[model samples]
Target: SLDGASDNETKSESGVPEVPVPADDTPEVLNKALSGLSSRWKNWWVRGILTPAMISFFFIIIYLGPMVLMMIVLCIQIKCFHEIITIGYSVYHSYHLPWFRTLSWYFLLCVNYFFYGETVTDYFFTLVQREEPLRILSKYHRFISFALYLTGFCMFVLSLVKKHYRLQFYMFGWTHVTLLIVVTQSHLIIHNLFEGMIWFIVPISCVICNDIMAYMFGFFFGRTPLIKLSPKKTWEGFIGGFFATIVFGILLSYVMSGYRFFVCPVEFNNDSNSFTVDCKPSELFQLQDYGLPPVLQSITVKLYPFQIHSIALSAFASIMGPFGGFFASGFKRAFKIKDFANTIPGHGGIMDRFDCQYLMATFVNVYIASFIRGPNPSKVIQQLLALRPDQQLHIFNSLKAHLTEKGLLPLLEEAA
Candidate 1:
């Protein structure tokens, strides 16, 4: 009776309750059993485990995360460099790079323009074709990029000369570009694996997974060698962590998503005739889709990552990703700092957390671009109807209809 009462209490949707029916299957007992199981599982891992598990979960959301993440990364990179400079300023401080305080914005522009050129291009193309307010940026991204690179390069090369000790300027100014290339490409590649989340998130997931696993493995099984730099880490734990990534990657590839033609967690907003995902499905209801087709009307989620891709990519991240961490450790060893900074308990500095991601991004990016890019650049995945099927020719009409509805396109065009 208590079991029946409890079941009714839990599943009841309204204040008025219907009479409980006795059946061959004791639903009340089943409910009690499920509740007990849930209680046990909840007790199995407390907040410490749950918190990281959740971060690791979002860490998996990087397929469509670049637009937002790299922007966020702009801030993180500055803070990271700030931390590095505070710790290791002796090297570049003497060199005198013109470390612009607002460099993050400039860096973001370069990064966004470089990797997401297609969307950015189509966006502005739509804008100008429609005779919209902000339309000039569509025609000449390359020219602008080329000019910026040229000017920055000139400054960098000048710094290499004997008279120009502009090493700092050369390093950071160029460093910004270098970072833009490496990280953005890396993200693009990883993002391709699922096409739903942003690519940066995949590498970030692998790195965080490796970190958490290494810690758990080391904490419980502390006898073996995890790696050289991280003395406490054990090989047993490391292997275990790697397996965990494989499992999660495999599982995450199977989630419910409607936006990606070939990715995970991608939310399909049909208005733009392209696949893009924000943080969650709720964001689709925001002001962005006015001109776009409703996601339900035009979007649908298809196949998930089969065992092969998940196994391969996760394995790749597990093995090669660590090299990035090792490299960071080597850098740390050279400087002799224990942690990046005591920002998070148990977790070290953001750089320390992101070390593997920085490295893994390159590996992931190259693989994706190669796989997706066809013999003809324009024809890359051209056989697929998604990107190539657009009937909208005039850029302005498209922009006014597509981007202006989102309200973001106008702002980005104006800012650019």
Candidate 2:
């Protein structure tokens, strides 16, 4: 009778059907399956092919058109750092992370001034001169550096004193890392420290390459679980990546041969065709014989270019890069985030993009600051001054004319 009435009213109710809510375990299981599927698809489809394409585009700009590439690199650093600070601070929500970020914004501004040698008063002047009272050595210089640091420290300490220990930790940890990074990179780029830059660059590059390669190889070949924290990873892939990165470094040293490299040529040394990091700018900038080979022979007489020590350095980089990535992965897991934010379809967030860069910066900063930069500190100022057009052509030409009028070409050339 229930099934035999008019079409609309004839349907059975199936004894009061129930709307089911899955058990707690069901969601967890589904999440795992979904994550696995997503990881597979993203890595296979986007990261694998697209990463190379992006890198190719990047290389094209870097080689054929560099100004934009440099700008992009600098911008990426700025943006990534901002995100790192943001995510790192998220854990300190109760401790006023937003305020800390605001302070950082101001700190960056002050740092720009300190490095660029610009001041608020400079805007009022039509032309800045050597005598501009606002130069680094001026009376207000120490005052400014002190004030900036003190302000930051006070804010940091106050956050802790207010029971914002979490934020305090972030601020404290980052401050140290910041000090380390700035000290290292500034010593190389600004000071032109060759050895430090080399050790740092090699390690940082190796580590970054290791991270990328691990992600790649693992996504394709990984089967065994490497760590519970990052379930998608595998020991096989890790091993492959570690070696791959070392090889990548060696190859990079080989491919980018015409530029600064760790492996000097045979003419540079007679140690039987190995690799070495004991490189000199004179060698790198000039041809093989007159430039680098002899400089290396004078340094590492016994070790080949690809000696044990050289491998050690590359190994450090290859390892550290993945270590950094693992650290980032742990942080992400704690937050239960898929990626830092989805800025890249596959790459996750800005912090995700720079997780390796952070470690690389640290690696480069350390080596350069410790041994490679050597001793000179004032070279940057001298170089920048000499590089100035007013000091280079105009001033030199005028001096040359006076010297020539005095009939002193020998003295002029010697003085120059």
Give one digit per residue, the lDDT tens place, for model 2 in 1-416: 22232222212122321222213222344345456565457346555554676567655654432224324544664565566555556544433443577666655555544543433222212222244564434437657866887887677666554333443565667645653443333322322212323343455456657777887788778889988777887987788888887777766554443454323211112243221335454433332322237646654332224323335556766666666667878866665555655565456665676566555555554644564345544434444453667667776788788878898977767889
Instruction: Give TM-scores for every candidate, taking all chains together and pairing residue i with residue i.
Output: 0.56, 0.57
lDDT of 1 by residue, 325-356 (tens): 77777766755555666554334565666667
Query: Stretches of candidate 1 above 4 Å error?
Result: 1-119, 122-135, 154-194, 198-204, 256-305, 370-416
Candidate 2's error at 145, in angstroms? 2.1
- RMSD values for the candidates in order, in angstroms, are 22.0, 15.5
* Model 1: lDDT of residue 165: 41
